[model samples]
Target chain A: MKPFDRLTTSACALPLASIDTDQLIPARFMKRSRADGYGQFLLHDMRFDETGAPRPDFPLNADAAKRAEVLVTRRNFGAGSSREAAVYALVDFGFRCVIAPSFGDIFASNAVNNGLLPAKVSEADAEEILGLIETTGAAVTVDLHDCLIRFGNRNYSFTIDPIWQTKLLNGWDDLDLTLSLSGDIGRFEQRDQAERPWARLPDRPD
Target chain B: MTATRQPQTLFDKVWDAHVVTRREDGAELLFIDRHLVHEGSFHAFNKLKEKRAKVRRPDLTIGVADHYVPTRTRALSEVAPDIAGMIRQLDDNCRANAIRMFGFDDPRQGIVHVIGPEQGLTLPGLTMVCGDSHTSTHGAFGALAFGIGASEVAHVLLTQTLWQKRPKRMRITVDGATAPGITAKDIALSIIARIGADGAQGHAIEYAGSAIRALTMEGRLTLCNLSIESGARCGMIAPDETTFAYVRGRPLAPAGDVLDGAIAAWRELTSDADAAFDRAVLLDGKDIAPTVTWGISPEDALPIGASVPDPAAMDDASRASHVREALDYMGLAPGQALDTIRIDRVFIGSCTNSRIEDLRAAASVLAGRTARVPGLVSPGSHLVKQQAEQEGLDRIFIAAGLDWVGPGCSMCVGMNGDLVPSGERCASTTNRNFKGRQGPGARTHLMSPAMVAAAAIAGHLTDVRPLLRSAS
Candidate 1:
């Protein structure tokens, strides 16, 4: 792993409420295999012009925002269907953390499970951090140890669920969780099968 | 601790009763009754094969190959390479096991959810599971359905069971007749706008009332399909005559006595007039406008003539943050009128609104009119594609210069080899408008299928009510 990493990138703020998964990574890009390069397609609809030129009007085209590692998004940041492609795009694009006031339930989990830090801060804090980053090219530092985030000279406060916090901190997904309990699970299965013969997998006696 | 249950809501009753075992940490083990599998579930099948496990109920398990099957052709041997592989895997997996499968060549071939309802495989008072999220669409017919992962799919295939924590129940009621041009998509979007997407988080939403019941089965399906967008496990409407009528005469639907008993049981599945919910939200049909999702998420939506919500106007931290970022990504300034925005292409299809009704709605708009911009109309399933041909809807689409392609979830996520080219802005019917939902660098503006057609004709975000009025 990258250690208990702390990254402070200029915040590229998108000030629209409710960003759906499509805008993160459109469906056309989802055709290619995960290894075939989808990150380059991120925001294709908005970032490029008819001739595929970078839309100068796009915030992503702004030189300062181009290198941003922190994506400051609007409320309901990951709404709509639970497409993991959205997370894949963001993660692959070098966006290590996303700061939004609110996030979609499934999207938040999807992001967290993919090792992206999805933080919920107050709108004021979110705006302030965004403002600081955009105006001053300020950096935001995420400290997993204290469950806190810092932007510029000020410390921003937010709450992430402890369970998800632990998961993100440890980069553990459901399979990891199950595997961690393999010992107890194995014992439980053995004893249960011995006592109740019908519960074992495959249902065929060895 | 029984809370005087009198005519409890299906959402409430089903939720509470499903709690098999509760852990102190707020998760629970839920009992699953029916498991729905699809083409994508071949991975799960392979995983189970590695373990050499057998599916629990060959009957309870149902598989379909909607994702990879091409709607244009019946010959499976000649499909696109990527899609053909998935089709072959699904067939091989389903045949090797005793599970029932709806193969691509079957007359019932279509999207798993579409076929599930069409074949009457979806019924009231049953908990259904699938490997895809929109499993909630079955809830439109009063079934409790949710999505699971590949591993979970394997677990269900092996054991015919899954673990789930019971969610709180919420009821959203719509009263009165809808104004012309206002569709189920508009209603669902309006509710999301009011609740901020996460309003129904951790809750199972039961859609009830006159407007919900008045909808066609397809309309109800589109409505229930977006429940996950609102962060709910499912959205449901009680099984009424409308539900039964749609299920009748299907290949696998229960017949005669079986159907009669099923209907009788469904009659008792509704929430009594006295039923209450953890949360109740009421909307008048007249208040709903021709809605379209303006930003990335489904919740980030507005009526046809409405202006984008000004981020500066929001007081809530989360709401404000979303407004700003979504606007920035959308390239739409705050308070900008959504109708004024120009569009380069229009897409009409996907799981959300790719049924026959959706096609008809688009065809009605595109009839005798050439789209000012590039346009595409993709159906949800092969059956829908065939039904449209029988009704000549495909002719109208083709005459209008819109690509009339086969079914198979085309352009929804670009999984089946259909995609919107990068760097293009599209008015689309499929759910989500994330940065590149249509393709890498593709910008999507989520809207109803009719709206997509309207956008195609005008070459921008245009209102459909006037077009509808003119059509008549």
Candidate 2:
């Protein structure tokens, strides 16, 4: 995964609420391998009609949004499904960051692990950013180091888990950080075996 | 002087007991008691292969072939190659890891969430993780269960632990008694409708009050299965007699004196009287009616007697536009009566409502009555199928012209060959009402099994109460 320290790029506005994972990348497209790029299938249903014709009215299809690396949407973005393929679609489609008032819990975690920033700003800040991006096709800078987003002379501080921020800045996945605590994990397991024997399942033959 | 003991919510007790280590950054390493995986876990297994890693605790992990397995037949030769390959991958991965798996021919094989509890793999005060979102269904047993992504699945496979931040607690109390027709599905829909889609965002909800306590273990599972639809981290109920009775005598559950000891420990898995929650919501169970989703989001629900909501009547511009978009996708008119809307088919299966109790509820409604439209009845598990058959439920469904098939998340996910036709609307017992969740361009109206059966008889969305009244 690529390190996500800072990115200044053209941004697009979806201006919708509760954009779920099924909408992000429909379930039908999930059968394909990730190695086969999911870029074409990102928002597949919304991007195209039943006949597979691209809907010109969609914001992402507009000329200004064609090269956008940032997406500004409303709250509960990527709301349903725990499919990591949703984040894979976003990253594969060249989106480095998604700015929303809030995000689905699992989606946020998947985003960070894939080096795609889930920048959570206040509702008002998200509305402001969406308006600016939709109206002016603004160039937004998402700075992970400062935990801030800047566009149109306005700076909005975003909220992210501190550990996630650190991981994003360092390009480190959870396994990288977790493996460092191997000793502590082992000690806890031994103690837990004594304290909560019922919690542990007996070993079964394969 | 002794330090005062802090009163803890049921979620707190379960979560705190599993914490292996806590970081200053607010992340805690939680030891996963049970890890359930389905065919979709191939991605995680692939990641493991790439890293040359082995599952840390094979004993704690179990696999099942459900998502991509064919429900019509267990024969791989008759299944689509891609779908067959997916099921094969899970079987091979489990074998490589020395993990127990309920594969295609296994009688215990079912939807991951359904069989977890059925096989007694899900228990009280445990931390369970799965690759599917509906994994929260296991929280019905007072367990701290939630879904994880592929990368997180691989993390658990390698370390037998997960890193998570503690979520705030929300208590939803349903006080009054519900009417006969108001099933757990109705109560769940009412709660989601009351609180918008993101109402419980970032919180772990503990369901309490008389109505909740009265629900059977199957009903509790149905209720918790939809928790993710409301953006809740998880939904749980305090383990009680119902939970203990349900867990008893199951294959994987403790037996004899060990069972007695386990029950004693499980009995203590409840919120202290003085425990405080971050938020509290109160609802009258008597107010809950047979409900259905009229739009894409699960929150776009209403009682059967109500009409579709007009976006123009909404105060918030964002919410209004969302409603408008949903209405457009669903092909629904603003003022149209929900009961008058016609459905092309009906489905009585899913992790949410495919247990024996759910099947019996649907079968009772469908008995001696022919369905007006085509439908399918896939049980939650093969065992459930056998039980339903023994009860003559399969004969009733077949007599009514609705196909009775094997179980494996058939039409609920449409991962297998079973899919609702494009542009067709289906009255279903599945949890999601999202666009194309049943299939591409397929519209889903989520409701209870009884409600779905009623719709199959009426060929549209109709109130199930009157049907139940007449049936009785």
lDDT of 1 by residue, B1-472 (tens): 4668566787755555444444455654454656877766765776677777777566667778776666456686766776787777788888888667777776766777777777667766667888677888889888888876555676667655554545677899899999988888888888887886678876889998899989999999999988887778688898888887886676566667667766776777788788767899999988889888877667778888888888788886665766676777677888888898888888887778988899999899989888988777777776787899999998988888888876666677776666777657889887666565566666788888888899898988989989998999
lDDT of 2: 0.90
Q: How well is each residue in B1-472 modelled by candidate 2, as lDDT tens digits? A: 2458898899999999888898888899999999998888888998899999999888989998888888788689998888888888888999999999999989888888889899889999999999888888999999999999999999999999998989899999999899988899999999999987788888999999999999999999999998988889699999999999998888888778777888898888999999999999999999998999999889999999999999899888888888898889899999999999999999999999999999999999999999999999999999999999999999999999999999988898898979999999999999888888889889999999999999999999999889888987
Off by over 4 Å in 2: A202-206, B1-3
State in Å the error of residue B25, model 1.
4.2
For residues A1-206, could you state the per-residue lDDT of candidate 2 as single tens digits? 78988999999899888889988988767777678888888999889988999999998788877689999999889988999999999999889999999899899989998999999999899888888876777789999989899997889999987888988888977897788888888898899877667676655643
Q: What's the DockQ for every one of the candidates?
A: 0.20, 0.67
Q: Give the true-contact fraction for every prediction, in order.
A: 0.31, 0.56
